[model samples]
Target: MNILGLSCFYHDAAAVLLQDGDLVAAAEEERFSRVKHDHGFPKHAISYCLSEGGITAQDIDYVVFYEKPLLKFERILSSTLGTYPMSWGVFRESMITWFNDKLWIKGQILGELGIETEKLLFVEHHLSHAASTFFASPYKEAAILTVDGVGEWTTTTIGKATADWDGSGENKIDLLNEIRYPHSLGLLYSAFTAFLGFRVNNGEYKVMGMAPYGKPTRIEDVHKVIRVAADGSFDLDMDYFSFHRSTNRAFSSKFEQLFGEPRVHDSVFYTPTTHPNGDHPDWDRDVAAINQNYADIAASIQAVTEDTLLKMCENAYDTTGSNNLCLAGGVALNSVANGRIMRESSFDSVFVQPAPGDSGGALGAALYAHHVLLGNKRKFVQEHAYLGKQYTADEIKNTLDNAGIYYKHFDNDDVMAESMASDLNEGKVISVARGRFEWGPRALGNRSILADPRRDEMKEIVNTKIKFREPFRPFAPAILERFASDYYQLSDAEKLYPLRYMLAVYPTKDDKGSNIPAVTHFGGTGRVQTVRNEWNTLYHSVIEKFWEKTGVPVVLNTSFNLRGEPIVNTPSDAISTFSRSGIDSLYLGNYLIKK
Candidate 1:
């Protein structure tokens, strides 16, 4: 049976196609629309998935949405009533949006796909997050955890899953418990994100990146806003937060008073000019003090978040008594926290899907519908992030030729890899677009900008010249899997699968990592993707060639996009970005382009 899964009308809209329990294709709407977070109907993504599966809308046997709308509406209605006059403005605005757009998801699906209403199905939001991880994981039985911004009524869930024995056997998931709305770990982090002069959802990672630079001096102040228990369950003071009552603000007056003043958005980051103890005349303590303060708050929140997550994982372990654990949802994307969980938690094995956020919920919804609801046995393993649509050689060539772009064609893969390896060794930044685009927020080998990780200045060059992103934001490393441990300190090489998708951060070897300054952060950790040849051939070969040339098996790798843009999906998008940016060369399939 063919199942179509959709998650949309929220950030990271996406569609997934599953044919006989196999994930055939998945793509995010933002990739096609050129919007960073397209939260509208995923028409383009749906179209691409259908085309990739070689089927029409009528061919789909079941259509499953990622969440239950009416249930979510109920939560909103209750919260609004509970808060009453304080919630009036938000409640009024929410009702109008829901009535006009959200409540009509059924109609939208029916109208868009020309399918019968009976064929459509809905899964609880957190269930989709849990199913996405547990079902996609290699473990037959594992403890499941899902945490994100409020989903319907649940902000977090702890569950258990058992795989089906065969096509006729029983497959099941039991949700042991859940934490409800207005007390979300995601929203708590997002509140800090906004207060730290970053966009809420978009800038949470920035806070994570900035944390390692400073001490967690404000941790005590941060605890005033929320309280945590020994078992990881927690509650927000509510008096310190305004998200429950107002759309315009996330934190309240009490929160501001506790943390002093919020940072002004888009202001310059601060650092002290001299040590306060030493007599250094003409040092600007006034100018440098606030930046250090901002970094300290970032560090404090990151510490609290990691501490809370570790508690949650321990509680999950104690409850389920399972050595294997599966984690999903937006909060799971915190690589630093994930590293801490892996190192500090009782679970021996942990699995997080490539797209752990809402985008992956589409796949989870479909898997949940097929395996749990339909009683079908599991058969697929999501081994790589190449599940999105890919362009054929002809399609890429046509786009390049039609654009009148200057180009050179390589005779074969060997020559292309060798050429690129030479460019990277010479410190030339190059954006690569080959095979399918990655499915998640990370860019694996296929859609990445690569540079020599060994060069100290490579970070500044790529950030300013190509990415146009923040200078402080460190790049990730795409390292050959066999050589990953040489540069990174992995606890267990046997359970290093999470590193394949850049889902975990690892401490860089002190002697080895300092040699590759571009990828290693100031905290001495690197978000690394371990590339195995079987998963991606050309990518592995190029890295191998680079290793041969420089004896360093890692490259400073980042998403192939400019700041505020989604990773390029089509050949045209690649050419457009290449032409506009300061990248040294564009590797589009076997062909190359230069100014």
Candidate 2:
């Protein structure tokens, strides 16, 4: 049976195709549309999935949407009504949006796909998040946690899931407890994200990156806005937040009073810690002090978030008594919190899929229908994230030639890996665009910019010159799986799925931090992606060759795109990014182009 899963009308809109319970294709709309965080109906993504699966819309036996639109609309309507006059603007906007497009999602899907009403299905949002991780995981049974900004009426869910790999048991996800909207950990963090001069959904990671520069001295002040219990259940003090009542801001004036003042958006962020030598071009003591306060607020919220997640994981462990945990949803993308969960929680293992946010919900919707709704046994495990479109050597060559680019061609993967490794060793920043693009926010070597991790200056070079992103944002350490444990504090690193997806951060070994200063964050932790040869031979060979050339078994890897853009999807897209960025070299399939 063929199933088509879709998540749209929200950020990271996506589509996935499943053939006989196996994922055939998956991708976010932004990659194809060139709109960062595209939230419209995923027409381009759906078309790509259909083309990748070699099937038309008619071949799809079922069409499942990631969430119940009616239910979500109900939540919005109720919330706006409860807040009354203060929420007039939100209510007006919500009605216009819901009436125009969202409330009619079923019709939209049917009209777009030409499917029968009987073939249409909708799953709850948090359940989709749970299934995204649990069904994709290798574990037959595990504790499940899904946390994100309010999904319908729920914000967080703790549950237990069991899959039928051998058909002896049944596939089930029992979401036993949940925290409702207006009292969300995700929203609490997002408020801080906005206060720290970042976009709410888009800039949460920037807040995470800024946290390491300062201590969590404002933890007490942050606690005043929300209250967390022993079991991780929390409630937001409504007076401190305006997200439910206003469309423009997330935090209220009361929140500003508590946190002093909001940071100016898009302002240069530097602190004494960032520039110990006081060498910043715009070095002003007052501005640095303000930036430091923002960093402290970031740290304080980050600390609270980690502690709350730890409590949630502990509670899930105690309630479910499972050694394995499966995490999904946007909040699961918090690598720092994930690391704390892995190390400090009771679970022995954690599984987080490459795309743990709304995009993964597309896959989860299909999987839920295949396993639970259709009674089909689980058969697929998400071993790697290379599920997007892959370009042929001819396609890449055609694009490069048509663009009038100078290039070289290599017939063997080993030769290409060796050449790229040599380039990286010589301090040349190289962007790799071989194989399929990754399914998540992380590049994961397949679509990554690689540089020598041993050179500390490469951090500044890649940030300012190549990516044009924040200087404080740390690059990932793409390490060979066998040697990951040597540099990072993760035990059995090769077996951990989160490590493979770069979903967790771990502290570097005391003796190894200095060796990879470019990839290590200010706090000495690295978001490590463990690479095995079987996953991507070229990527692994490049890292191995780099290891042979230099003693370190890691390369600094960042997404192969400019700032504020989605990762490149096609060879043409790659070439465009390469031409625009400061990358010294570009590798597209068997072809190489140098500036």
In order, what lDDT does every prediction score? 0.89, 0.92
> lDDT tens string, model 1, 401-480?
88777789987998999999999999899989999888989999888999999999898889878888877788999998
TM-score of each: 0.97, 0.99
Model 1 residue 273 lDDT? 22
> Which lDDT tens digits does candidate 2 get at residues 132-186?
9998999989999999997889999999999898979889999999999989988
Mark the 10 consecutive residues where model 2 has the least summed lDDT.
488-497
Top candidate, metric lDDT = 2
Q: Clashing pairs in model 1?
A: 270-291
List candidate 1 segments past 4 Å from native. 165-169, 273-284, 491-494
